[model samples]
Target: MPDRVYLDWNATTPLRPESRAAMTAAFDLVGNPSSVHAEGRQARRVIEEARESIARVLGAAPRNVVFTSGGTEANVLALSPGLRAPAGPVERLLVSAVEHASVLAGGQFDRKELSTIPVTPSGVVDLERLRAMLAGGPPALVSVMAANNETGALQPISQVAEQVRQAGGILHVDAIQAFGKIPFNVSELGVNLATVSAHKIGGPKGVGALMLGAGIEGPAALLRGGGQERGRRAGTENVSGIAGFGAAVKAAMAALDADLARVGSLRDRLEAGLRQTTGVVVFSSDAPRLPNTTLFAAPGMKAETAVIGFDLAGIAVSSGSACSSGKVQPSHVLEAMGASSALAQGAVRLSLGWSTGPEDVDRCLEAWRKLSLSLLKRSGETELERF
Candidate 1:
């Protein structure tokens, strides 16, 4: 593990030292954040400070930030049926076909009431199809991710918000991947609700927040008991984890511009090297994408074997394909982008992070060169055997 190059930032990031320090300090305190005693007040203060930090980042009021276990819980909390916007209560849920698994689950909505809006061959949501679906629905709750995890394609959120507004619907943005990487302001985008994970930005893995825009109300408690999170979510807060999240958010935003420039440069260098391999196909190359990510594939390669090849070479990359029941399948993201099954099955993702250095990128490129060469050799041998 000493010489390993980790290029899976899209899945998770290493916890920052700043976040670790904050959590360590919080552990010294001994009181439930929901209590009213002096010791409890101290813990409550820590949680509230963390809430304010996240709220400020998302352009939301402190009272509107609801802390949850992680991004998945936050997404589930936001998709509630009782949520109310200025227009009215949402009657159905509409999510893009390319959304994360949690969003595609449709939350509390029944399958009959949920709709999947298609994306274009380039991976952007089809606006016309969305319009047609919204035209007849009664203030549907639309969930869309700000950026795709696998392809790193940035969705047209501002435009999607406008259309939802015109349709008298509410928009929920899963901004987990984009929050720390780009300038993401839920208020500026006119989204009703937005969710982000702490771990994706170098914070603790078990915490996240759901930000409610002004005038949105009652996402209806997913858990009921305590008066925590303004009664929107219950149970005592993970004070230490929230403290870590606050520190991470502060540090990430403070260094946003510089980090982005460095990480982006590394990603560009990596992608350029990757394309030097023959038959490499970089997905969503023509669309706006996250600067830190590259999803690519070549003919005659499959994700499972390539991932193993990269790992054996002292590098860490990921297959875009999801493994189900011990079987590898094509990435839904690429399939939605009109990639053939063979190409989708071969997709591999290499993502950069704040700590990704030139050496890491070079290491990944070297590993890829070896893997690609082996793939071509195997393919050629198969052709010769066929003749």
Candidate 2:
């Protein structure tokens, strides 16, 4: 078998060496963080240091960061709605139509009245529609992702936060895919809560954080346990994972400029290679997007078939969102962009990351050229690549 090309960074990133080393070093310690013994104190020190590192990258105070099981848990905790705080009047949940399934399935509010802000054809949130929804009387909680996982379309989160504030609402931005790849400052976004995952940033999986800004409403406990995460989320902290996460965050920041430059160039080259052939369309091409993701479709090509073909060719890609894999459903993100079911079914996403290089994208394009030719033949279209 040939070496596989991994272009599905939106699903998860490979563990970086720094994160691996941190986790290994943490494993040498033998104390519970909650204990008062010397061993416990050492463990606590590691945790606190990791907390500070993560807080620094997010431009948040260390005290305000709450570590959770992962991004899913972080989002679920962030969406908890209650009038526990003195801020007053908390009643609704507004989620962008393109949020991850975790946010959609978090059960933060009554499912009956959950409001969805529509997106334009370009896969951007319809601000006018959002403003109209905000005009109503219920106190709202708005959840918008920093970027779409499939299309890489960047959301106007700062603008969304302003709207939420004007409407007396709280905003939560899921920055899982945007954190390491893009420039992010919590102060600039002005959101009440932001969720970021470790694995998405080359840290270990199973650890993530929810950044709570000042004045955000307190969420009811998602898990009831022996009082962890400062009573916000209750569970034994994955101390090693958190340490790895901190290391990954620092490494990502240090490499951000070089990564952004490399990924942008490689992504453009791959997209251009695909476009050179006929019957190819890039989703959200005209909109601002992350440098590393591309969602494209060819006429009469089903995504499942394309995915299998690419996989057999030693390339890995995704049809829609990785979180919704094996569900046999069309992409909600593409449907929100007004793509027909056929077009949506034909779309596949290729996302690059820190480990990606020019050669990786080149390999992907080569495999794509072969697969596209075979797919065209099977669909009875003229062989565009044969020329």
Candidate 3:
């Protein structure tokens, strides 16, 4: 375990020291935040401080930030029908073909009313097609991720937002993958709602926030119990997790520029090394992407086999999104990008983090080289047998 090289930060990052410290401090506090006593006020203060901290970094008002169980819940909460501007409910749902499983599942909408906007070969949303889709439909809720979790392809969210606005529709941007990896402002992006997760940015899991734009009334409460989160979500707060989320946001924002430059360089080096092998193809290579992600595959090489090979070599990588990694299926992200079944089945994702170093990249490259050679040799043997 000590020798293991972790290259799957996009799945979930290692917790930051700042977040851990905050969570430890929060654990010592004893109070029900909803109570009227002094202890209750103290607990309430902790949550409010965290709200303010996260809001500051995200360029949102503290009132507009609603904490949820995680990105999935945040996304589900945002998908509610009437949570948009101009007073009418969204009658349908339209999501990108390459969205995370949570978004692709079409939260709150019936299956028949849900539609998929296709992506280009480079994994970007097709804006022209989106325009046509919007024109043909009622005021639909268009959900597009700021970045694809598996391929790291950045979506044309700003452009998409403009189209959605012109069509009198609402836009919900899933920023879970893009939150700490790149700069984004909900207002600037013209998105009515956005979802962000803490664990992906070195904070605790089971904690995320939904950011609502100014004057935007969020959806009705998903969990209506204690009237917490200003009736947006109903539950007792995860005080420690929220504290960690706040600390992680501050730390990630402070280190964003430097971390991006460092991780981007390492990703480039890793891809260059992987490209030395024949038959390797990098997904979304021509599109704008996250600074620390690469999804690549060698034809005839199975992703499950390659993932196991890397694990045996003490390097951690993933075939695709961690949520769906356990399943032996082709990546829907790649499939939406028009990849063949063979290429989709072979796709592997390597994502770096702020803690990644040159040595980590070197270790991954070494492991990949061995795996590629073994697969190539196996393919050669099968061909010879056929002859």
lDDT of each: 0.89, 0.86, 0.87
TM-score of each model, paired residue for residue: 0.97, 0.96, 0.96
What TM-score quantifies how close candidate 2 is to the native fold? Answer: 0.96
Candidate 3's TM-score: 0.96
Comparison by lDDT, 2 against 3, better one: 3
Off by over 4 Å in 1: 381-387
- Model 2: residues >4 Å from true position, as ranges? 83-87, 321-327, 383-387
Cα lDDT tens digits, model 1, 63-109, are 99999999999999999889875578888999999999999998887
Give the number of the best model, judged by lDDT.
1
Residue-level lDDT of model 2, residues 147-248, one tens digit each, is 999999999988998888888788889999999899988887787889999999899999989999887657777888877778887767788998999899
Query: What global local distance difference test value does model 2 have?
Result: 0.86
Candidate 3 Cα misplacement greater than 4 A, ranges: 321-327, 381-387
RMSD of 3: 2.8
